[model samples]
Target: MNICVFLSAADLDERYTRPARALGELIGRGGHTLVWGGSDTGLMKVVADGAHETGGRLVGISVEFLRGFARTGADELVVATDLAERKALLLARSDAVLVLAGGLGTLDEVTEILELRKHGLHDKPVVLLNTAGFYDGLTQQLRRMEAEGFLPVPLDTLVHVADEPADALAYLERLPTAPQVR
Candidate 1:
């Protein structure tokens, strides 16, 4: 499987680093390809590094505008012109999406993917690596949307939460066999 992980390039704290690294390793060992933001800093770098260390095929998609500030080079990176283009390319090339702990940027990426899935733009699974209950509020908001009828998507369609990297990868592997999509 090809997994596209969404995470912030700013938060490189231990709280976010451990899981991102572990998850990347697990994804690589599990024989999955990794697609991620091309930046070589912060949590994004952690993930890419882990995957690359484990010998996983690493593919990066970065926005052209952020190329310099991001300090990510295209000699080894697959660069896109903008965020929208980058996201579309990632979504199109991946089999799943894993969201790690991040700030507003991460939230935006997750929400955008969710909305896209809702409209049948993609059928891939989206998994949230909820390390230390980081996404509790977001999960609650999603439930609220379902309750208020503002969200037409089934809970199963929106997100899958995992407490650890292993569990997250397991959930992803089992997604296609689950009865929900069928």
Candidate 2:
């Protein structure tokens, strides 16, 4: 399966580096493809490196302008014209999506995926790796959105929250083949 991971481009602190590497190794050992942003910095580099260490295939999608800073680890590189195109290609090519601990960019990507799901565009599984409760606040906010009727559907129907990388991998492993996003 091709698992798309949304993560920070910023360097990971010790808190996240270990698990990020583990997640990458898990994907590699399982023979799953790692799909992600094509940057060479931060968690992006870590995950790609970890996966590559185990001989896993990596697919990176990035805006054309970022190619100069893109990493060289990806086995396949896809250049998109803009952010919108990058997001579209990321969603379209993945069997499942993993949300790792990150900053604003990660939030934006996850929200976009949820928005897509809300519109009945896809039914693919989306899991949030809430390492060390990193996403607890966001999860609460999502619950609040649902409670306030701001969301079109229940939040759980759109994303799954996991506290560990192994757990997220388990969830992904259990998912059926991804359906085509409309």
Candidate 3:
């Protein structure tokens, strides 16, 4: 599977890095690909390193402005003209999306993906890796959206909330778009 991970570019606590590393390792060991923003710093680098070390393929989608910081030696690196194009390319190139602990940018990417899924634009599985309950508040807000009729589709159907890296990968692997396990 080509798993697109949207995550932080900032240096975070070990709480976040640990799960990111585990997820990347899982992706690599499973013979999957890591498709993500091309940044080579912080959690992005940590996960990419994990993937690379474990023999997983790397496909990076970076913006023109951020090209300087993009990961080197990626299996494939594509620089988009802008953020919108980058996001579109990232989604188009992946089988599933994993939202890790990140800041506003991570939220933005996940929101756009969810909106697209809600409108039936795509059926790719979306997993929110709730590391250290980082996303508990957001999940609650999402649930409220469902209850308030703000979301046309059930929140559960829209996104899977995972407490651990393994759980995240397991959920994605179970989805229809993922490769059939032998």
Candidate 4:
């Protein structure tokens, strides 16, 4: 499977690094292909490096604007002219998405993908790697949306949550195959 991971470009404290690396390793060992923001810094780098070290197929996608600042031109990268283009390519190429601890950018990406799924644009699975309960508030907010009938999606379609990397990968592996549309 081609798995797209949404993560921040900002330098993360050790709290976020460890799990990101572990998640990369697990995904690598599972023989899944990795797709992520092509950044050689922060948690993005940690995960990319971990996957590379484990001999996983790593494909990086980066926007032209961030290429110089992020210094992420890995051999596997597919560059785009803008963030939106990069995201569109990633979503088209990935079979699923794994979101790690990140800031606003990560949230935006996840929400966009979720909205895409809601509109029947895609049926890929999205999982939130909730390391140390970092996403507790967001999950609660989702629940609130469900209660208010603001979400037309089934609870299962929102996002899968896992406290650990291994668990997240396992859950993804068990997801029911998307049905044929035609």
lDDT of 3 at 182: 39
Candidate achieving the largest TM-score:
3
- Give the residue spans of candidate 4 off by over 4 A: 69-75, 178-182
The residue-by-residue lDDT of candidate 3 on 1-182, one tens digit each, is 88999999999999999999999999999889999998999999999999999989999999999999999899999999999999999999998999999999999999999999999999898999999999999999999999999998888889999999999998888776677633
TM values, all candidates: 0.90, 0.94, 0.97, 0.93
Instruction: Output the number of the lDDT-best candidate.
Output: 3
For TM-score, candidate 1 versus 2, the one ahead is 2
What ranking emerges by TM-score with the best candidate at the front? 3, 2, 4, 1
Write model 1 residue lDDT over 45-125, tens digit each, in one string. Answer: 888778877867777888887776443432246679878888898888788899998888788889999999898888888
Residue-level error in angstroms, candidate 2, position 180: 16
Candidate 2 CA-lDDT value: 0.88
Q: What's the distance in Å from true for residue 8, model 3?
A: 0.5
Give candidate 2 regions above 4 Å deviation: 178-182
lDDT of 2 by residue, 1-182 (tens): 88899999888687898888899998888888889998888998888888888867899998898888788757999999998899999998898999998999889999999989999998879999998889999999999999999998888889999988899998878766643222
Error in Å for residue 175 of model 3: 2.3
Candidate 1 clashes: the total is: 0
